[model samples]
Target chain A: MRSRADVVVIGGGIVGLSTAYHLAKLGADVVVLEKGYVGSGSTFRCASGIRAQFTDEANVKLMKYSVKRWKELSDELGYDVGFVQTGYLFLATTEDEADVFRRTVKLHRRLGLGTRIIDMDEAREIVPILNTEPFILGQWNPEDGKASPFKSTFAFLMRAREMGVEVHEYTPVTAILVENGEVMGVKAGDRTIKADAVLNATNAWAPLVNEMAGLDRELIPIKPFKHQLVKTEPIKPGLVNPLVSPPSWNDSYIIQDAEDGGVIGGAGVEHGPTYDVTPTYDFLREVVRWMTRIAPPLKYVHIIRQWAGFYAKTPDSNPVMGEIKYVNGLYIAAGFSGHGFMMAPGVSEAMADLIMKGRTKVPLDWEWYDPHRFERGELRTSAFQIG
Target chain B: MQMRAPKGVMVLGQTDGEDPRENIIICRCNEVTQKDVEDLIDRGITDIEEIKRLLRIGMGPCQGRTCIPLVMGIIARKTGRRMEDIKVPATRVPIRPVPAGVLVGELDEE
Candidate 1:
């Protein structure tokens, strides 16, 4: 049996759903296919950290637009996205690190991002528990915040559906029906969805879809790494903002979820030789060690719960967007490197523009983030790629 | 200790009818009930693997970190097997949750 639609979007993650949502808003007949329940994949497990801190102007611009959309999400979607503007604090413990932060903040200021390089004293005022003893400088962006990935994606999906997007969950894309060197549609189970355009929005599983569509391309080698999040029992004192140690000491950050009265936090623990999202005793130990070092009051707090999520990696540690070279009627928007949840809205908008109107104001035309950049032998490294 | 019987198997010490113990939840994320587990067991899902496959009890984001031990205990009590006799689910590598940012950074470095 076969079904047809104007567009068939594979993968129901935030990126896929957001793309479907935008396409629907553009008055296109769209259908979303998913192998699992909504937000159950990488989206559900996301840390939900949204930040505008980026080394690339394109990423900064996209994330800035995302932040704008996030600000209006509650009104736009008619649901609370749990978007809290607690801000992002990037601490630097060394002079070299401070220099890098200074340069980034200057660029951010030029873009009117309102980020500043503050001293230990100002950083202390924002997050009182920060271990200023080890850090001399910090990059403080008062606008960066966190939100619930589930709620945000749900909002988008709901609003998108209201705008006439059809979504099918637990429907796996068995194959891509391509002919004459172009994508015809997608086949899910025994159902074939015919469409003039196809989008490969599956994040970690992007390479498989690319191969299925016969695109001579692969995602940015997004290796799935696991990290654990531990939540402490309710305490009296509350944290005001997110805290991140110097990139050298910790490759991750922690945030306080006052909604549940628990200090929910995690770090980018070292990855092993494989892609597995299992928990370990060593992770629990390191989490306690670091949490204690950062927030002394948390040392004695009993850990009530813990869970793991896979971090998808890209080669440049930035999201890969825009059209692929060889495959027509096919677009690629994967390899977010763990920043996809927050960047979904703006990224999807840009992708929708490129798909519908052929050009976008979202500045995604960087040669570094080019879809075939690796094949073209061009790689630009960005320094602000923190977990 | 709360002597509530494991969700579905009815291991000798459970409250009567309808409401099971709120604290005794199977698959913390999905909240699969004790009755849910017992139904799965009665339907020939006595083994942990089969139970997980049928009920999706311990296959959530936690990946059986907390629920597996309890599931093993339940299976032990019901099948007259030791807790050690019940095998733990397979543990894979990258044995911690990671942010996508760090994962990508590591890949870029490689």
Candidate 2:
């Protein structure tokens, strides 16, 4: 590992690697430190769904840009990331939920996203086995879809390595070296690697790193929430083409991978902050119940595997980015809640621009995701946080 | 002993001079060939889980029972890792396949 670099990113998940790759592309000396093997964290466990049908304008814009990047990612990275634009179908059971979908679709279309509200018949046409009895309508975005998380993460890692970004695996950052409220470097094991800037891209574990940087809990307030998912044995392909989510069904989602023919689905369960990633019977039952309700044919399907991971949740369900106000050169890009994988492409580029040029040319509502928002008591309304 | 083929019948082990290894199916449920596994391994995807996610190697009805060890051997051979050191994929719940209907109970009960 190098003893010094222009910037040191403190994580090696998709976000960190993509950011490192982008930073290296910008001609910055970058080093990525991973506590475990690359993508062994939440990236490996993620559902890998990418979408832009968000209620918030900023989120819509950001994800639309991200989807655009995902479309071209395979060519850009010189590796197929398995990106498929099968679309994302958001089901609505109640009038209130339908109203939210209506408004979100309007906002999405206004931002040049071709998301539209579809009737029950159209929804059934998209997913032939969809249980339309539970959902009155669905919001469909054909531009949004799913990708291979492992492929994308490895793509970025390989490209970053090719671009001379040094990556050290199984090297945990023990401390963020702060002197007089200015970032110096990080302490990993017995060595100290001096750096001009340090970024806390350790999503679920961002709080621990932030605290190490002397940021108070009140100032950042990022918490980890455990989310569980299950994969069913491969059946015939095209059973469920799009990523389907019903907001009323515990925020459940079911999508079948076209390449693999395995049906992957999950649901949210109310839980406090935790680091536990053990798969639970309760989560399995809940996901099966909700998924079977969404698509009754899934009841006959057999679950092959189950796992859990963390969503680095902030109060407003938005990420905290940008440099720490009182601490110079200490930047953070964590607290993505559950949408980091999809937002990675755009986030990495914007974050790279921020780190190198001190501001991002990529248009996004920067103030809403400002690292000082918690301190200033300026939390924006939560983004659409469906599974 | 040499087996003689009938006038219209082909021998069991004969493939008309094709590569016999191409007929070796590592994952029968998915029809994944030995070459498929080696091709991915050649691409630097040595991890079993990453290979599974990308190629759908052991994601079929048998749930990796027949192919996991075979793929592990291939990876161990290709990556120079010992058989014991190659990480296995996680075995998930129900152990055996349980129908989701059984878990959710009767439809009328809801």
Candidate 3:
């Protein structure tokens, strides 16, 4: 509604706000159009588990870059992002799984991460409440942490605003104005906010937005899977401070918040891809079944709350970043799966660099995530999981 | 009969029956206290939806059935927003628990 801007980032979640913040910092006029309140999307509903224990090189590099940024984010943004490095522990049961994890540990060490494969005894030492009967090996990175999702999103929004970015909540982008296969502007509500470039950070709803540009059929389906998480009542403090990834991922991960001491966890995320965020009774049941064996203490723990979120899953579980080659000035920043929350710092910097300087100096190779990679039959796999 | 109560010792016992405040639980499921809602409002959470997401006021397994009105009342009173203006987030399906048995047969999801 401000007539026009240098760029229009469609989506006010953390990704869009981070993009706007970087773009505005680089002296570009940015207008963020949020269909709902900022962070009201999957940003606020995520389990807020920030980890760097990845099997893929690209993901590991991105998260390794992110962990450093998160450490310095509060100072940079002038707001406490509530980053707590409680560590992320993965439980491996089978011998084959443990062997794979041992190799992963070497890869992690080479990447400058402190991820080491510890025996079951060390796992119990790390988390006193952990039930070690189900597992033999554990993978842990002492530095992998989580932050306040709402706080970080709000901080990014504030910094972006301070940099002169105009954020319009309740402003849904209706269409993207294109001409001659070149980028143009975006239509939001009744007004046309003309711009030379546009970034699609609409996550789960990217498919609908892609349709406006007449590029729907060409892209791989980024389905929206409904994932749910539950929070337990404040439990007595124990050594179980680190976030524990259940053996086999078992559709669950448990972590006690540093502040509230509330054990936040979830499982049974095999829920089908739908816009429906309805938390099912199945999740509560699964939580009980898994919690009973994973952590004996949580068997009868009261589930104080439960909420659902969307995992914007791509064909390979890897995000499709960088620019859409065929569409000039049109950048793709969504499809980060569940890791989008933690990887925002790196992704935003790369996207901003690509938009401003025509390239990113970040260690990541953007070509691997090209939107047209599927067309060339080059599907990349990522080791991250969602519950 | 000998006096059993210690003179200066703090009595550690259930006080719900003695103190009216202890029994007054806004959201019985989430155990949200009235003070909790007010404290959130003090922190500048004017919108109902924002409060819902942050405090998990209406996010229990009962799906806000018991807490929505109570939370809305607190928000409406504090923010001066009319009840109609402070909309409750729509409750989605599977309001009741869906047995895993239902989801097991259809493993091949496209």
* Winning model by lDDT: 2
User: Model 1, which residues run further than 4 Å from truth?
Assistant: A216-220, A272-275, B1-110
Better of 1 and 3 by TM-score: 3
Candidate 1 has a DockQ of: 0.04
Error at A201, model 2, angstroms: 1.0
> After superposing candidate 3, which stretches have Cα over 4 Å from the reference?
B1-45, B54-80, B90-110
lDDT on C-alpha atoms for all candidate structures: 0.71, 0.85, 0.78
TM-score of 2: 0.91
Clashing pairs in 2: none
Tell me the TM-score of each prediction against the true structure: 0.76, 0.91, 0.85
Q: Alpha carbon lDDT of residue A211, candidate 2?
A: 88
- Give the B-chain TM-score of model 1: 0.67
Q: In DockQ, how does model 3 score against the reference complex?
A: 0.10
lDDT of 1 by residue, B1-110 (tens): 45555556654545455455444676775566666776656644466754654455554456578777877877887778899877665653334433322322322211
Better of 1 and 2 by lDDT: 2
Scoring only the A-chain of each prediction against the true A-chain gives TM-scores of 0.93, 0.97, 0.96
